[model samples]
Target chain A: MKNSFVELHARERALSLLDAKTAREIVGPLDNMISPHLEPQNIVPESDDGIVLMRGMINGNNVLVVSIEGKFQGGGIGEVSGAKIVAALEKVLEENKQGNTIYPIIVLDTGGVRLQEANYGLLSISEIQNVVIALKKYVPVIGLVPGRVGSFGGMSITASILSYLIATNKARIALNGPEVIEQEAGVREFDSSDKDLIWDTLGTKQRSKTGLVDEVVDDTVDSIKDAIVNEIKTKKDAHRTENVDFYLSLLNKLDLSKKLDIDSYNKLYQSVVATKHEVPAATAGNKEGTKSRGRLWFEKLTGIENATSSISTVLHAQKDGKEYIAIVPDSDNKFPRVREGEVGLQEGFAVASIVNKIVADDKDKTVKRPIVLVVDVPSQAYGYQEELIGIHVALGSSAAAYAKARQAGHPVIDFIPGDAVSGGFLAHGLQSNRMIALDDDSITIQAMSKASAARITQRTIAELEEATKHVPAMAYDVDNYEKLGALYKLVKGIGSWEATDENVVKIKQLINEAITSLDGDTTLHFRYQTPIAKASGRKATLAVRKLVDEEWSK
Target chain B: MEKLHFNFDTKDAISKPVHVGVVASGDLEVIFRPTDKETEVNIVTGSDGFKEVWGNVLQRFFDRYPIQADIEINDFGSTPGVVNLRLTQALEELKDEK
Candidate 1:
């Protein structure tokens, strides 16, 4: 009889991977640590917060297995759950930094952000990515997707950053689920009930063949263990998010006129030649570009009116020794889903290409140019083709670029004058160390659209709205988002579209203020260190961090 | 969500702490810690108005094996059978450790 890894819960999964009798669980269920946000929203809180942090040996090598219990709330990452992952990974980073050499294996079975605790999920996921990038300097950070709510949403983007990825045939990986696409785009874009099409598009076998997932294995525990052990020995890093040239070249070949199918996409995937493509800086176009808060702000800040680039959606320019990047809407864009400025395949790859260029240009400079992100994305492009082509990698590419830029000591700042929602926000806004946003109600910041969030959480729109009043993280408006203490300065008296001469000056001063306050700090610790965060925003996160730090060396 | 607390005057003292089950759909997680005091059960369940069912289930469980422990259950609409099965599962682990 074969033991199926996918059938086990998170704790059992972690134990099955570790050496017998050597496994010790940190922050176990008996600790009484639960999500503070759940019960208040009438949701039952899990004892261990659906995350299992186990430390032991994998084949006599030091290992830490972080497993997400998919059976619980679809493994949705809440405040406590997100903090648990961030704290454990940070401990791994500390251990690796001190030469202890503990391998961190993440078993991903998440649907990205927990809608119940939305902003914290985004913040925690970004923090987790930062630690993963830092840990890569020492050892390979391994990832495992063992079916049963396989990696989706922002966690899939995190999966793209891991050194190596292994998934069983039982798993399926994508950025947005089919149901979400149907809810957001339309039923014609993706029929949520069409299970066969979904599996064929997102299943691990297709993913492996198309280079989304690195390797696919049998669902047996022994097979997954062997794969993990082999990856540890070989130190195989897919560098899935670093393949900017390949994706850009693939995008160049992709004909937007025809709807992409599996066979044609596979053909295109095999035919990519990976040419050295460089995205030129944003320039003043002859005609006025599509109007958006992002485009308007980019135009005012960069002083390049009608700012447009060859990529059409992505606009980047250097002004006064600072690099400004924006993903704006183009109503006439050939990619139909991204016309309203969603972070689509082209926008993600294009932003990565531009940011990577900036980092490369300033590689040896002590005074690295600060990168400002003019964020106004409504969401990530929701379409069948975007999912089929691995939009997570596109989003991950730019996110990894921004993280790498910030990690390399270039101050990354986000100026959110408009909507920053879902994967669009994850790919663009969340990586910045300091965020300066307008105190305007026009801005909508959240993990998913209300309709999709309601459907996914099995709550009515009214119930979801009611919960938002109690939980600041659940609310979509920027005013509610500020309660999370993630922003550096929420500037008042400035409307989203009112970029007057004086307003632009005020915004510019705040941006400079944000950059100077960085003081060479690269970590996302500023979010937690804020006064509001300490008081209530991230109170649970702080406690979890303290607990994990105390429990790590034991 | 409903919170329920129960106290049982049991005699057999549990030797160690044990945990079993998951708070998945139609299931529940039970955590047991050894205690010198009376056996206490505290539950935060997704289902409402299950106080009688839970009491009966615990009554039958403690009748068979009166183990003194601090019990905490986080349930998500598990049936009486599942509640008994998970309690028995934790009981089996307790016996295995012994």
Candidate 2:
């Protein structure tokens, strides 16, 4: 039998099972709401519309359901379809205002924008993301992935961007599908064949184990329904302490990737698989150590087109008698060599000192400047010698610097003038309160190529490409990284160094406006979209806010 | 391909499907009911020469849990611990009247 929510509308909306008639209401074209993409593709349009918008009562509470069918033009979304989803989300938010919180359940199944429709689908996707983000404010977005057409493309990325994701053992999530990797990186990288291996790589189990997916269940309606009901019942319960420590402990263990090999990866997998660690509980109310007292303001200054050829530069303070400084701390594990005689200190000490300087410089000033995190590291230093020297601490020190800047009423605004990859990117680029990439010129997150991932997965690139035709995440590029919410913006350019007198003037104006709305003490506003505090802390109230909002509005 | 029809009426066999308690490691469970209609049995496995071995095992278990039902089994190297538990649990769940 088809699952209640995933199957066709007629089956899902049947009034027989539900207590109220809301569940079975006809939507879409059945209600005359067909997508514009279907007409062009010459596909027989689904009567209820491509976007399944089901409104009904589930277990005594009102709920909203939004789903996309992969079979229909690969479920590529267009304006009308996107608008319907946003409308449903907006309605949920309105309901929250009225005290009848709605839940938003997105049964994701798509390959992304309808390539045939071109930019229409792409623009629609942006709007959809905005809607989802807004809906996240009032209610939680429960991402559900199932069926033969695993979530990928924009839909999959959206799922990843959501606060809580529920995936079946059958589901898979990724940005670039496998075929794109094969095309760009060549066949040596990813072999899409060997179904078992591919499934293992992108399966829900792998994602859940990695903490990307919140839950994994059997492919059945009852299993899913039961889980949802469980959340609803305990939505007001306190959070567990274990979740808080999990992130810190996981960060401590992140080195598994630094010395990555098949053997080491397998060992890590075995350790996780062999034991189910009891996640610690979080304290009720705002815990002392976790609260932030001030807001961090960030802005951008576009660099020159070709003359300076830099997006944003991290300038060093003066050294000796000169106003210019050089040689910070040794960062590279192997070549702990600082840029000798250079105006800036060594990379290691520079990151630490920059935080100190930025915070101190802005302390007495009425309006604080966003710490400009000048990033331009090609790759993390790699060598056997470096491994023994504890690179994690070096990276941690850099993280500490960003954390300090964030706590001191300063936002870490990272400008990627060049390449950012792996741990290097996480240490600098990702640490920013918000990261904005330079339009198409910057190479953001997603290091190596499909070939690299394929090599790691042990599949021939051609085979992987062929397989990716069905598996969507492998078909990706730098542009696809934007869909993952990693790159907050693709700006034209932040302004030039020569125009700095004017640039600083404009930058200060923008900074002043941002700071005006902030509470002087709070360093940051936990992006409300995050359910980590609720899930790990097991804070029932926090959990309810998301649950109620999702049910009523989304 | 061979065709086989199966129907067993065991004294203690249950007639409904109900709660789900275990789907974790080392255990599998489901329920079955004799809808008193057309039902069939088919078992194919990669493990060599286990047809009669499986048939006899199913026949004995069906008698013990005698409930009329159609049974289908797909094996992926399951252990003996799993086989008995799955059969019993499935029977109990089928007996549960939702």
Candidate 3:
């Protein structure tokens, strides 16, 4: 109970780890950097937007401690909060790049993307992840889960991408929260009221035992700080998301008929011998595949109708030296949660295998193969099995692969024709340099489903829908998403289901144009630099980044 | 959400800005910025029709301290006691630094 790190607020938590008079808060509460999106929804905004960014020394090592306030909005990362993290981490990345070793430690206590800010939360989290990946090259990016609202949703996928994760027994980490799973997949799938079951599956102790979290420390401030200091001093790196082959091998060993409990999953996880997994391009088959927009577009673009692959859900092929990947639905797939084309275990690992292979193959080439992702994912598979086996890592693997591919000079593009929701979008769509979506009302694009988001945010579906009308970030349709200026281009004259020959040709030309526009630039800064992003979509984000840059130096 | 603003005439003037508290449930954040003009307290609270109660709380505090500053409070259904606590915390922050 003495100097408990988990008990302290976000600001106090940041200051506790730093030496006396050594801590300097960047974009602190005095800066008045509140979320502009909250007030319109009649929600009272916090001055720091529930994020405390501190730049100081941790045990004499230059460090940036980014703490999320669990008390405020369940530590949700919205526009200002996400921007503060991205900007601060990017600054740390810059400092580390200059041979000044500055480690970035994220005190994660978030519920991931704030459903209120919806698309912006997704965009900001992805931006934060992109910067984290870049910073890992210079210094080990450490993450700490100190209880209350443990990392979940898109941020857990980000957590899985960290160099090392240190957590107390008070914390839990998973891609989807228990309540969200219950809402999406029913109570039989996961009982939200069962606190024991929830904690047993997602607690840091189990996570540490299963390798989801690196270390489980005591609740004291000293213990948490010591773990962080030890990690920085030792430069310990977990490389959590790089094990595509191992996860693929693990997925191969999974038995689909029966329910997988926690103990059985742990045993299966340990018993697996990681073998090489090579997901080949989809080839023509006699039987028709599931007819989703992603599948339709993949078939039309690649001219491989009735596309069949070793992994049924994941289909990827090289057409004109440009690699195309899509995750489609399988009505009779072995994995039930992923039957509706959700980015589940196999889809994530298989996409990672394919993308990793593409990156490896193009390592020596002068020009890298441009990856076109046909994003039509509904949501991540929201069953207990997915969370029990750590689906965050699966999502993280693909996300990291795409980010690395882009960083390695491969132009990763998202051609969203269907749904682009939650963790599936993060793993597949959000990592790209450019995103082009069809101008169709049917294409649902947001952080979470309306039903689940309403439940989590404690608002009725009607209230949630009403809020969306005021805030574009809260909207579910792709048109509202485009308003955020996240898309590289909102392609018109084509329905989501309309992938005709001429439409395919048009899309292919747009894809080529988007790739050419990159001009060897690999950074996700393109999103911020876009006309829509600059105009209004990311106005607060731009302001937050500017303030962080100005204050980080001071 | 309701926005309430109150102005007070005060003698003592402070020249430091301090922020305290989190806008959590049943809690609020208070920010005090030094002002050359008349002292004022502005609040955006989640609970409506608390204008007179907030006035009483702030009026009581200012009667004792009479600090001249521009104070802003973002309250999320915090009781009068919590508001007084955060306001007093912000004053302590100011005095400690001074």
Model 2 residue A383 CA deviation in Å: 21
True contacts kept of each: 0.76, 0.00, 0.94
- DockQ winner: 3
- Give the poorly placed runs of model 3, Cα more than 4 Å off: none
The local distance difference test score of each candidate is 0.92, 0.44, 0.91
Question: Could you arrange the candidates by lDDT from highest to lowest?
Answer: 1, 3, 2
- Assess every candidate by TM-score: 0.98, 0.45, 0.99
lDDT of 3 by residue, A290-389 (tens): 7899999999999998999999999999998899999999999988889899999888888888988999998999889999999999999998989998
Per-model DockQ against the true two-chain complex: 0.83, 0.02, 0.91
Comparing 2 and 3 by DockQ, which wins?
Answer: 3
The alpha-carbon deviation from the true structure for residue A488 of candidate 3, after best TM-score superposition, in angstroms, is: 1.4
Which pairs of residues collide in candidate 1? Answer: none
Question: Can you tell me the DockQ of model 2?
Answer: 0.02
lDDT of 1 by residue, A267-369 (tens): 9999999999898988887899989999999999999978778899999999988899999888898899999999999989989989999999999999899
What would the per-residue lDDT of candidate 2 be over residues A1-554, giving only the tens digit for each residue?
Answer: 65644454222422322445557332333233444333332223333335666777668866777767555445665545554565566666677767777776777777655443322343345445545545555666666676556675445535644556777776666544555434443444444564665465566766665555677777667777766666555442111111322332332343633434434544454454222222111112221211100000111222211111010112332211111111111222223221211111123323444555556667786655555444444434332212222232333334445555555556455544344443344345444544444444434333334455455434577755554343222333344444333333444444222224554455444433434434453322232223432343212223323333444422
TM-score order, best first, reads 3, 1, 2
Error of 2 at A332 (Å): 9.0
TM-score of the first chain alone, every candidate: 0.99, 0.51, 0.99
For candidate 1, report its TM-score. Answer: 0.98
